[model samples]
Target: MNTSSDDASSTSESVSDNDSDNVPVIKKSKASTSAGLLSEHNKDNNEEESINSMHRNHPPSVTLEDMITDICFHPKLDTIGIASITGDVFMYKYNNEETNLVSTMELHLKACRDIEFSEDGQKLFSTGKDLCIAITDVETEKLVRLYEKVHEQPIYTMTIINEHVFVTGDDDGVVKLWDLRQKGSEPIFSIKEVEDYISAMITNTDAKYLACTSGDCLTTINIPERKLHLQSEDHGDELTCLGLFKMESKLLTASNKGKMYVYNWGEFGLHSDEFPNATKKAINCMIPVTENVVITGGEDGIIRAISLFPYRHLGIVGQHNFSVETLDINNDGTLIASSSHDNDINFWNVQYFESLNVTEPQKGGKRKWLEHNLPSSKIHNRSDFFAEL
Candidate 1:
């Protein structure tokens, strides 16, 4: 793997210079007296504390009112949709000047665990603990259709396959494929793998392959073929989420055991050889920033920037007071939005993301990093960050 593009050292170099200059320096005389030793020790402790405080990530960009279970960004706009535990789904339009609530709907009686916008960005579909799936019109801000009791158990996750199709996973380890053209509540196709509750379902941009995870095992399905493509060995821990990268060449699954399994997409039916321990606590959610870098949100409430090859912790982006529940990057890959169990959502500016890591899948593949306009310098001051929020 080409891990040495723009080393993470560049990011540290940019921030470290400004930080080291701010630390208070202490001078000690060459005296061998106990008083002199005591003074040096105290000075060392103070410096350590100051350095940690300086490196610590800042607070959230906006604090929501309910515990967020899921979040999704619009494909072509500066809009974000968040589903909360209190049956609230909020759509907000955010820019540098303001974060405005575009629409608010209480579409479910219980927690709405997942919400995804259609490819056209004109409609939204959500499934939740109420065992119902609802479709809403984005422009009208009205309920378009409701599929009641679509699953026998609570629906934990959902993914939009295309403009007309989507998939939903229930707590009973069932995966159901839905079609918008159908009027009935029944799924067009369903798959039952194991008894363990289905924790997550992820797909590549093409939506050709679907990967599902449960407490004990991982499975990948070929969507068009409608057959199982791979089933990994029992991980011995509850898997919470999965991420895909490099044109879907790599697959990563995270567990409640604090371990992550990496699989090569080409070796579909084989066991994964790489297992990276990202945290000692559960990694509840993760999103790939590039082919080699991924950001994870853990039960410790910290969002970590981690590199896959020569795996290492880069640093933290932001934090929460409770377990981070979900993470999403906007379609353009310029912003990262994270939600936590503490009822808050944080937005991070990723202007220098491409410079700090490798985004190209193949060594000589057409580089897409320069497609977007990255700011000349990243915004550092938190006061300048959430001013209008």
Candidate 2:
């Protein structure tokens, strides 16, 4: 794996020159094996050119030397911020034609754990296993803020609350809300409500509550009061990811046991609904595609499109040879980016789902992730829409 020091600006070698062309054959350096995790998936798609393998053949993707830990798409562009195990974060501009390295930040002594683009897309916030918090100016590629000792343990998760305020959680379960307007590295409000590390965190649209999931529980903090709102009873499994859908009224947390524990946004204690994963493999990462559809990456290396309300796995979006780690969608709802320990980042065209929501139907979205792709005749991808909203 090449660190920022080794080769930060490595250009994408395999790319199609045009978007209208046939799906490009994006191949990885690693070979596939069924050593383990071969229970149900083995029977689902057995062929090399399986039906679910989207595009003309193999879908378009980038395979870097470094193992990817997390993916954060830009809020306003087609840029992607990738955190690597080598303690560096690389930003790249990608499309169907090319993937060009834009910038690279060597911010931590250990691995960069999480990264978030500010709401305005002006600054990039990152926390790492080095117990540090860094804010980098997007335009200048310079460090604007750095808290060398922001936490006692490694910071695992973080969320942007508003224009000035943001929150972070550490491996020791301490949650700290910080303000850019504040001078010191210390948080404006600090609390420790969970016994285990915070695995994921999300805030509602109103930014009134901060929902955090941990190894065994979920914690909610009232933002206006700056205090713990409620902590749920032990969920008996590690909650890996969090998402809000159904117009932000319903909440769901993915578990290590391959289940979705649903909770009402205001009422945050025990889960009101329990949904099971059809593959029965743990969901490690997720991002909402639309209000009703969420895309999840599972422990079995498959990225899936799942629907709410009826609660069913819609279809496979993409797959890796290793357990999936993170998922993100670009500023445009058309493409979905997912990463796994396999050192590959794959993109799936999801503009099909947006066609169902927008006034005019989108075109170019094909059948690769679902049982069948949406009708491509009218499928197009628009930039103004974001699923997380």
Candidate 3:
């Protein structure tokens, strides 16, 4: 494996000049294995060829300013929204080779931290460092409403709870629940438990619980009960990202310390022995490709695939020129998109992703972790596991 310092060298290689033409074969070099990841000599010749083939198959990236903070795909359309630190939101129609700007809106006065589309993809919601939340009509490209000073500090994280409700977390470690119908400056509900910045928040499949993470602890709140469920002790690392697995029965949090902690849902005090030293570098973002499989982007600028049940490294999927700031998958799971603290957002093709999501894991096969007290009823559908909504 190459060291992380060499990851950006891979991006120096030019993409194919012809957008319509097939990607030319990549000559093996330090650039081929960005960040000194897997070397061609380490895998079977055919497997190495396949990995290179996939790398060559990726679409050209969308370039933007370093101010770009977040990107989200429209639920039902071929549209993408780019939010930037400069407080501008740009909409683009993305084809395989090119991204055409559809519209641009300057709504926030400061950095736009995060953005999400409503369930129908008709309305877009965004939060900003300006302490405001803005809703835009996707079809008309008009600002529907703006909630100013919604939080005391800069809002950094957000999650769509459901059609009628959404959630936001700010730098002050405050979490607020908002109702779309209310459209008020004040939130419908608010909670302040963690003393540091809110790094990430996630709602379960049923929206029965919401999990919030900071530099050290993970806090769970019961939605219906509107009360604290559990607060885990500090993991001694900044929890940068979180994901759920095993039918949402397990919670995994990745830290800046290059470790991933796995906990049984609702039991937050200890980590399961299933995952240890999940990655060598600090992970910034993660998305589940399947119930038992996930892809993570780290401080090293390399993106890797990992298996959950037995905690094995699948392999590296791709790399970025800088640390990956965020990750998103389309509704069909055919494409995985990642954004960095730079001007580029890269797209990768997930071959057979649909088929893989639908098929059940083979029993008594190579994955011994699936055989441990695994119950038949515990199986969850692909959408439920990813919790895209």
- Full-model lDDT for every candidate: 0.70, 0.73, 0.70
The sequence of per-residue lDDT tens digits that candidate 3 reaches over residues 1-389 is 00111112223432222332222233344435544435533443555356444444544578774346888888898777888767788988876657788899887897788899998999999888889999999889799988988788888888999988888888888888888788457777888888988888887778988998886998888877777778888788788878888888888888877788888877776666435564456888888777777777788766766677766655456666677777877776667777765556777666544354323444444333221211111123233334433
How badly does each model clash, as a count of residue pairs? 0, 6, 2
TM-score of each: 0.75, 0.78, 0.77
**Model 3 misses residue 113 by how many Å?**
0.3
Model 2 RMSD, rounded to 1 decimal: 12.0
Candidate 2 lDDT at 14 equals 30
The collision pairs in model 1 are none
Judging by TM-score against the true structure, name the best candidate: 2
Clashing pairs in 3: 2-36, 7-35
Residues 1-389, candidate 1: write the lDDT tens digits: 00001111111111222243223334444659999888877876887577545433222255565556778988888899987767778988887546788889888998887888888888888886889999998889899999999899888788888878899888788998888899788888889887877778878777778888877688878888777777878878888888887678888888777888887874656545555564568888898887778877788866777677756555566556666777888888867887654555677666466787443343222222111212211223333233333
Clashing pairs in 2: 362-378, 362-379, 362-380, 363-379, 363-380, 367-373
Evaluate residue 88 in candidate 2 and report its C-alpha lDDT on the 0 to 100 scale.
Answer: 90
